[model samples]
Target: MKRILTIVLLTISITVSAQTLRKYSNEFMNIGVDAAALGMANAVTAYSNDVNSGYWNPAGLVNLEDNQLALMHSSYFANIANYDYLAFAMPLDNRSAVGISLIRFAVDDILNTTQLIDAEGNINYDRISLFSTADYGVTFSYARKLPIPGFNYGINAKVIRRVIGKFASSWGFGLDAAIQFETRNEWKIGLMARDITTTFNAWAIDKDEFATVQNAVENQNQELPESTELTIPKLQFGVAKKFIYRHDFSILTELDLNIRFEQNNDIISTSIASINPAFGFEVGYIDMIYLRGGVGNFQNELQIDNSEKIGFQPSIGVGFKYSGIQVDYAFTDIGDQSVALYSNVFSLKLDFSIFR
Candidate 1:
């Protein structure tokens, strides 16, 4: 046991000393778009049962029995930014399903102060402009339950686009795959591979489009023309269980771990880290009303320094389901000591079985 503990400690130390967070393009892809999932700190990979599952775990789309549509919107940091998502799913048969989804994250109407002055150093407030930065994605998802009663597989093909104030833009593509298993006794397991083919973004900047403004503003940095960025593949595993105490009362609990492989400058060789572990629970009453809570990013010991707390986000939410409609609301704190940040998310879902 002592030897094992020593090895474990050494691995963690090596990991911490070797890796630094690398910047990636289209970071909005990492944001959780589903209110229910985010409310549970994204531990729903194994408990996916709704249309939003198209984004969380495509295999979960097999759980849908009706044509479903879901919409969600979130306001972050007191309305500093907005994130929205929409998804629709339909069952093609008893064992197959397909889904389509869209994501938009944006910060609009920001003042462009870089060109506020003329070349002769005269104040030109009229030269100031307003612009928006936005990221978008369209996803096509397909899921199927194998001949085996409890096994399912799914895939997602996604197209990504990002615009930065009309000065720069990017286009990218990626794929994700997932598998899930369930038993008669309410135990579930899931695995997901995100960006399985290595999502790549090819950026094209029209620097000449801003040439007039650049000439008007002195000492402004020149924009680059083209570049490419690759998003490394990520793997996640989850397990969940449901406990039923009464016909109408039950609780669901889940745990998830995320792993990412990236270039590590601090260590001689590439290091592996199971960095983000999340825990969540849901209490349901009659399947009509629900309460949810979760905590994530508690990687205190995994950090290289005392001041850098990589994890520590907590969230809570509530939901109501009646007839064929479901409504949910969630609150999450994503703050640090210097910046107090919080987000509120709301979602609505409708299910209708026209073919049934």
Candidate 2:
């Protein structure tokens, strides 16, 4: 059984190529959490004020005036994958705040091949199995207003776990830091460092489990061994401003720059790459409803092949607020229309202070 599982997982891992200069493992962490942010092409680093801040820019948590909770769910990768996020934040004091967040990405109902064949090499419907591949993360965040009036600083400590249908698993640890500054003229600037300590994922595979399907494992030429994947540091810088037309209307615009560094095989030379530049815009009506649109993921080539071509991923979203409850919806084109790669995300947020 373990052998069969190993082969399946190995086959999946083999699909990834070192085709991009910005190569980092566990890319799932890069996925945006709430519909509000995704709708804005992930340009919310400077303007994040909701529970989603726990994931985007922890410094924004200081903007929370009351205890709040947020939940999000999205059908991704043409409905083949599911992503879910949850977060809660509360003010620790006038100048400080704390938050907790959880994320889970999963693909389920995968066929269990080990049980698919009968003893005589014949297929038996009863001998079937199903499993899932998932990634999970939990984060704790702290934010405090700085002595510099409109400035704030924050940090996030997180643990990550990945599992491959009882075949392989990994544990990782990382830290993130952020700072935000609000200018007198409605402009906001934010800087964030992700995995500053260099996150590491230590993977473990159960070889003993493979004994059940020894022949299958032997043919794959895979020597089961413990290994680790490292994710280097990344930086994000953003600026946002709101143009208020009237007491009842305003437009918010934002831009974000993502910089990543990678080391060469010799470990002597390092290179920096700008992974993507994101842009977002939102229009609000009396603070009750919002319309958003944005584009991101600018690159010369979409993939390894030069002919693939690259184009911005565009997204649109709508949000409404009633009392202490807010609801948001987003429609995103995940690129490559031929593969049916679009997605929809929905999120709900609640402010407990309304009850008080």
Candidate 3:
């Protein structure tokens, strides 16, 4: 039964194998924060007051009344775990703010494989090794209230790095800019641009650094291409609508779209067309309690479960307030698995605000 389970898992994995590398690749950096993840990509225009705002919509920082620091960590289902984001925003005398943040994502223990032959004239499993995928990026942002009031704009500078299994690494930079407009009617609108630099390039592999006595791996001994960086195109946008029935009740819904121009079969970039849509909503009473859910679907190209044949990317989350600190959690189901292959997601977030 265990063997069968493994087989079933492998089969399903193989089918989705194409997305392994780019599946978790995201434009929204604060993936672990439940409220954001549960609503697909709606957090882009959604108001974020946590330290994670550095990754979601830095423009939201303009609303801070005090300087605050934050940290967040997450463990993805499937033995994949990552640490991300630490930031502090300082509110100025006016409705302007400045903040700095750092985020990192890492995958551990990947088995390296090679097709090889042995002296016995038969196939043999030559070796297995562990490799890691990790990336770290630093961000700096500034937001200010418009002289006309009730309007704001912000921009961020990001320095990022992508490393692959010690064989290579790529480092570059990009920018994120945003605009926020608010009305007396309690309506808000926002827009953001990501990776304006169009970052690209991968590290050059050092063939000369190959481990000793191994002919099984490809290009055991061959001159390599000049070190080069892989190109990745980027452009993502998000919109949001908020409804406030009273001081203690509200409903928030948002939609996001991103487009990927280059086509590749790797795990480094997002699997979608760089042009995918994610929608989600949150309903709450008095800002004291909340409920949230959303979907991130890509039709036939990416389904949560092959059995259902529908890309049912559904998510749910909740939030609570205690004094001035708030806590949140989210659960998600990535549609595309058999009963045994569960892709459920859960995460927690904490927020501290000075305003009563």
Candidate 4:
């Protein structure tokens, strides 16, 4: 069963040429990192002020008060795939900060069935082998407070790596830019530009491995795939405000607009661009315990009757903080509103100052 599934996946991948520009290249990077953000349906652009900012909006890294480390893990597709993240951030003087983050998503133990049948037409289960497909991303971020008070800017340089067993691999690079501003009234605004320079991935396929599959299945995969994948720029704008009551209880509300250059099934779609809006809020008591909820991923879905229906994803989460250590958990979908099962995400953050 595993062998059959692997072959089907491989064949589908082989059908795409390298020259074609894919609309959803490097999609693994978009899965998000922190549980707090995921629980809020990824609406954290304006107030992500911690180690995870390296992946959200780097400009928020400037708000880090102490050296911090973060880790996260989540499973998807009924545990067939695993996603993990790690990050560290530190303040450089009082006005500048730097951070590094690493992310990985992988599916392991896929059976390679190209050699399941022997050359003499004999069935041989021993010839089957296992392999894995994985994607990795590493990002370095730097943020600084602008000369103007309450203003900050940041930049990120990212490297992307992907491998499908020993059959194919790719290396890609990209950049991100972001800015944040706070008003005297305590309203926060942020903008993030992903793939600001247009990321590119150069794929290299192992012809020998590919040939084995080609010989196994006739009239398919006859041509080698030589491809460079391109990812166009995307923008996210967000605004947030925090309301405090009784000096001990607070509520933070945030709204984000995710914009893509091409038209799609987003709520607001046009020839020039598409916009998907997300809204989230967090209720906190004494800054130690919190509850969060959000709605996002708005799309127009075609029902069985060929009628368009608006669909959205809703998520909820909880968080706890004590002595500079924070733990968060979220129950949410993996950005696909069609998926019936939601994923459980957990993350931990530690501030170095706790030891001091």
Candidate 5:
């Protein structure tokens, strides 16, 4: 299983290099950051506030009431991969905010069997080694209120780094733009454009390391892979409304539309683009305890009988807040709906005002 997994990873890396515009390039970044957002099926674009906004919708950062920090961790594929996140944000003034976020997703300690066989065809288990493939992302965000009341805009400068043991590495850069608005009636709307300038990643492969891969399979991977990868722009639009009852209990519902330029299995597909809709709601009591649920990732799957079936993922979570500290937990399928195993996600938030 380990050998197969290693080969699969190498194959995916090479395949990505061969394509200039990959539909899912740098997808680790899209796995999301906060458990609360994930529990909502990533429908928090308009409702996001606090430090987690740095990843969801930077424009929401303008709502920060004080300096805040956030941390999150989740494991995928039955602990075969780990994802981690950290973020800090502060209100620069009454109408502006700034934030920084970091994320990492990695698969570690995979056995490297390419060197197990000697040139003379002698198999030596002692030659086996281990390596890891990891991807890192850093984002700097800024948001400011517009001259128009209830209007705000934000921008993100993102850096991406990916490494496959000592075999290959890449560096990438991208930009994002976002806006949020609130209506007089208390409706919130948000729009986020990711990779607005078209992210680019340039790869560097070590020939010495790649030579082993080339020889592993005859008539396969004999040539060097391409070195450039591109990520096209995507857009997410969201609207949310909160209903308060008797000033103590509240419910917030959100709907989001995710648009991609390429056609895929999305529920709404067209030659120009595809749209996937997500819906989530949160019930809160005195802003201290919360329950959340959502559904998303609509896709049409081909069944064994050559029939197509529509499927979606469902998620639920709970949150607690008190004295400037917050903790959230979510139970969800990180993969597609077909995945039977659900991953547990946890996140923590701290408000600096607590120390003051």
Candidate 6:
């Protein structure tokens, strides 16, 4: 045990000390949009049920229940905007598939500010409690399953929309593809490419004319073109093995690797980019109960500041299912000292589906 721990710690130090930034942002789930990496190996992304497989692995859609729809919602603990996801898929003659999905970020409540210059260089303070909401991204997908035994493949496209409270919206789109392989009944492997054309156009930047002290820049722009034109999402490849302990009980362990297009400078952690490796295990006890836990960024350097990036992050979650529905929850934390306290994250997901 001591050897294992030592090796693990050594690996982490090396990873942190090593260089380069991977893409799709390192720990954005806690800081900003830059750290949101694609999730992996959740029960929601597990075997069997199917339906919303495209989000995790487009190829998984090949084996899902025909004609299905799943919608999930979660409220973050920090009183931030709620997170929402909706998925609908229909199998076409057992060979082809079509799907549509939407993910939106909505925040509630705001302290509206009023800027005024009174006579005699005197100013009065008046604040109005208000709320402004914004959302981005809509996806449309079409996939086909390969006839080869134990092999499945698919493709997808996403149209991104940037919407500000009531201002003009910006538009962009993305493309994705995936392949999955299975052997008899023992092992499963998957390779997925998300956001090939990760171009986020930032359009409505704030004009210097607005002297208001509020978040005018953010409120005025829905889609601002990135400084570098295009920043693509990192690529993820994973493998898993499943073991059955009983006729109705089973466990699965998976590992995922992320490689992005970020470059890291040895100093100050340019992108906090490092080869992120994650290990997760899932135990399904009976057909209705599921338990899961995982540590992200194990052996990877942990950085939470704006200058540095952290690719690997550890997370743990549990889920349960009854009939045609299921719910999943995950908790995550990263960073150090002052940043660590604010880095904790809680996520809730609900899946509802039916076969037509």
- Candidate that scores best on TM-score: 4
Clashes of each: 1, 2, 19, 1, 0, 21
Question: Which pairs of residues collide in model 4?
Answer: 18-227
Better lDDT candidate (3, 4): 4
Looking at model 4, residue 19 earns an lDDT score of 45
Candidate that would win on lDDT: 4
Candidate with better lDDT, 5 vs 6: 5
Candidate 5 lands at a TM-score of 0.94
lDDT (Cα) of model 6: 0.51
lDDT of each: 0.77, 0.81, 0.57, 0.90, 0.89, 0.51
**lDDT (tens digit, per residue) of candidate 4 on 83-145:** 999999999989999999999999989878999987898889899899988999999999999
Off by over 4 Å in 1: 1-23, 210-223, 263-270, 301-311, 334-340, 353-356
Candidate 5 stretches greater than 4 Å from native: 1-12, 334-336, 339-341
Give each model a TM-score.
0.85, 0.89, 0.71, 0.96, 0.94, 0.70
lDDT per residue for candidate 1 within 1-356, as digits (tens), equals 44334334333322222232323655687788767777888898888976887888999998888899999998776797899999999899989899999999988886665555556767687876777778899999999999988999999999999776666677889999999999888699999899999888777766674554444334434554466777788887999999987789989999998767753321122456435678999899998999999987554333455454344778898999888888888888645421337788999988985324
Q: What would the C-alpha RMSD of candidate 2 be, to one decimal place?
A: 4.5
What is the C-alpha lDDT profile of model 2 across 1-356, one tens digit per residue?
65367456645552231112223777888888989899998999999987889899999998889999999999887688999999999999989999999999999987765555656778676766677888899999999999998999999998999887666778989999999999998799999899999888877776654433443444554455667777889888999999988689989999998777753322122465545678999999998999999987665443665364445678899999989999999988745522337888999999998798
Q: What does candidate 3's lDDT look like per residue over 158-181, in tens digits?
A: 776766565555565667877776
Question: Residue 161 deviation, candidate 1, in Å?
Answer: 0.4
| Model 5 C-alpha lDDT per residue in residues 12-122, reported as the tens digit of each score | 666565465554678888888888888898899998988999898999999998999999999988899999999999999999999999999999998888877778989
Global CA lDDT computed for model 5? 0.89
